[model samples]
Target: MPRFFCCLPLAVGVWLFSLLFFAWGTVLTVVGWYGVSSYERTDLALTRRQLVSLIITTSSWTLLPLITLFGMGAALARSPRALKAYSTALWFQFGFSVGAGAYFIYNLFRRNDGNFVTNCTSRDIADRDTCQQAFNVLRGVIVAVYVVIWLIEIWGGVIVTQYATERFQRSGGGVQFSNAPPPQGPGPVILDPVMMPPPEPPILGPAPPGRFAPNASGRFTPPGGQPQPSFVPTAGGVSLPPIIPIGQSAPQGQYAFAMPQNAHGPGAANQV
Candidate 1:
């Protein structure tokens, strides 16, 4: 199975939630900046330093969620570069969170006497108390948001690291095998011997008309309608014998005529 199948849902969820978190932080930062810039000294409760700190804190919140977005994209793409980018962003955000959290805790507890009085005004006691309460509530909410962002960054980092490792291992010569077994070391090849048909006997055509084959029993008959005597082998040497055709008369002689001309010469009968 592909690594994407296992990680896609988590990546998508992180992307969506990061977008919402980024938007929320951006809106809060923008509103706080506008409020601090527009309000007069008498109307404004927080000092310039406090306003600056608020902007810084909210801007960090806005920026940190983008790490999650980066991590999501890295996971989806399964790219080593993207994963490295996400890791850098995550560590940077984590460090920023630690610093910001420290600053906020110091200001909230040590300098402000454990009361969120940055946004309070001395002109109206009721408004001052209300502003302090509101600041406290907002501070708590931002702290929770930071915690959530931390968790998201950690989770995203783990997932991206896992996927990147998987891709690396796959690319770095990880073998995938099918049903067939791998070949062993080199060995001598044994080929099957081919079977061939026996060589054909040489073809010999029919005997000539005036010739008799060496092994034939009949006499040689020439084309002129005349029977000729032929030799038959016996215990003795060659001896002429009479051989008369059934439809022809014998010649007036003690034995039949001699062998036909050219019977055993260059125009001899074809060998069977």
Candidate 2:
């Protein structure tokens, strides 16, 4: 599930609770103002000092709660202004509660001596004591509320810090959140296999015959047949030269050489 979905209801609840405080503060402020305005300032009534103290107490109660309400609204809206406002409100509440608690404690201790409840000329003696007891009770309640507010402020501060950190990171600034895992580095690179072209087919033809073909010794021989003698052309038309063996002379009359008629004696051809 998304983080926002889980947190949405909690945010809405805080907003509603702050709204309740706002209403409470408004009612207290109205009541304080009404009491101050309606109370007659005659010498027989409540003294000026007691009236001023009452006004200060009521104003602190009213103003701090309203400030807390504004802080809660800023927190719910997730505004950047929330941090300062919430912190201020928390501090104000804490200071006011401590001061009021201390004053009431002193008042309680001095009640017998008539320090706080002495000037109640408009009310019965029993009612004056009841009023001091009520003030002490209210002071205790405010202190308790301050404690709750402090805890809430601490929790809200953590949430706001987390959100602000995350937002800063997303905007390409600040460091990562503590709860988030660190990122892994880059992965290994992959290379593609190379492709090659196909080989060509062998040529087809007839082989050479007989002497042109290679023998067992890989040498070629001439065609096998008897050798023919070559004839030469001369003035006597054509003639064949006698083949004499090496180192042997030709026989005197076994073969006759034909001489050209022009080279013979004048009557040698006629005589033959």
Candidate 3:
């Protein structure tokens, strides 16, 4: 829930409100400078009372943004990196709010005979009394503008503080940031005989048409009844290929080689 408050919506709302007040204040200031409604009906006469009103009205425009800046600073205190910028904006906003508020209250207590003192008095007449009526109207408008500035600053400040609190709570009173995962290592390579060995040579043997003849040893023998080559044996008990005797050729369909087990010991060859 606290996390939710720190979201963009609330932050944007605060910014917008602050912006509105500043913008409105500027407009009011410009209009007051152009000679407001009260000064239009009067003969030309500029007085200190009207001058003060004018200065305050125009100053209020500058004051709004000042207050907004200060309020924004207070709002953004959570982010150390951005604190300086936020603080600057907040202070600016505060300055504007205070200036506008104070001037507005000052004008409230001062006025003239039926003419609320205003800032739009003309210099056509030398007497200060002539400008009293116009100054009053200007004062009223300036006061309203200041009131708006204060309200906006208050609203904006509340939003930022509340959001900051919620965000801190959600992060266990700390800041939470996400980081990317580390990369993975490459896979190991495996070698298999079937996948790596070269293609094998085709086995050569006789055609399948002949019937095999058997010798006295019950082994397949050549057509002439000759003794056939036998399989040899090796130390590991695996049979080695069979081999034909000298001067003899293997019959069809027969691979003439000795199995490993059939091979006699090394010196046994000399006995034979």
Candidate 4:
């Protein structure tokens, strides 16, 4: 479920209402400034009474397309960041349109001496009735204008809501926002070969004499003496190890393991 309200439509509707309304107000403002109406006659007191309604109505929706451009740009360009202010503007415009429209319409029908109290009063003595009559028809037209704008605004309010919902669903977005592009995949992984030697068994404490061991510096200390090469013997032109098989005896004149000093007795070596 989406937790955030997407109200772009409401914002747009409110903007259009305000732009068109203020535009209508601008016309009234000019009329009051120049002190003239349809027949070059207007009364200050009566004009003020008429202005109490304070609303405008426009034909052809002249501002709609321009408003659409600005509204969508503000929304999509800045997005979620701008939504707060946009919402506030929406409410203000909507409230003003409803409040002003209602006040004006209510007073438009108010009667005074058979003349609508909130309508034009003529200043011309000679053409007073004619000027007032022209204002009467113009007033109806003006009132219709206001009603149309108000109705359109109300309809816009509802439509904008649906538009926001449909856009969200169609775009598969949450919180009434358009979807943003997904992030790119990570860069390729690299494999490196490291040359390392496997660990050998540790030599504990002090090794026995003549055994491989580490000295104080942590390097292996060689045996006390230089290493002696393996020995091989030759008998009848065949190479043999220093010691032969236990069950075999050497040939009569051949030697296997030679006696160190003498054979068996002092005279044994003399006999060999």
**Top TM-score hit:** 1
lDDT per residue, candidate 2, 1-272, as tens digits?
11323666434444544565567667767876776786574322334554665566666767756676676767566664463456556566647755654564454344443443454434554576675675566557756755675565455444444544443454566555487678989765432222222211221342223212224453322245322233333443433332334453322221145555676664344332
Tell me the lDDT of candidate 4: 0.45
Q: Which stretches of candidate 2 lie over 4 Å from their true place?
A: 1-9, 38-49, 72-76, 113-272
Kindly indicate the candidate among 1 and 4 with the higher TM-score: 1
How much lDDT does each candidate structure score? 0.54, 0.50, 0.52, 0.45
TM-scores for all candidates?
0.44, 0.40, 0.37, 0.37
lDDT of 4 at 117: 24
lDDT of 1 by residue, 97-196 (tens): 6676666545544444233354354445457667766666766786786677567656655555555555555666345658988889976544332332
Minimal lDDT window, size 10, model 2: 194-203
Q: Report the C-alpha displacement of residue 190, candidate 4, in angstroms.
A: 51
For model 1, the local distance difference test gives 0.54
Give the C-alpha miss distance for residue 217 in model 2, angstroms: 54
TM-score of 2: 0.40
**Candidate 1 deviant stretches above 4 angstroms:** 1-25, 28-44, 65-76, 113-139, 173-272
lDDT of each residue in 1-272, candidate 4, tens digit only:
22213644444554454455446545644653444233224332333444534324121222333334444555465343233343344445556656655665556556432243223343234355665566567568867876776676555545444445444455556455448876899765432223222223344676654344555554443455333222232332332222323453322332355555645865365343
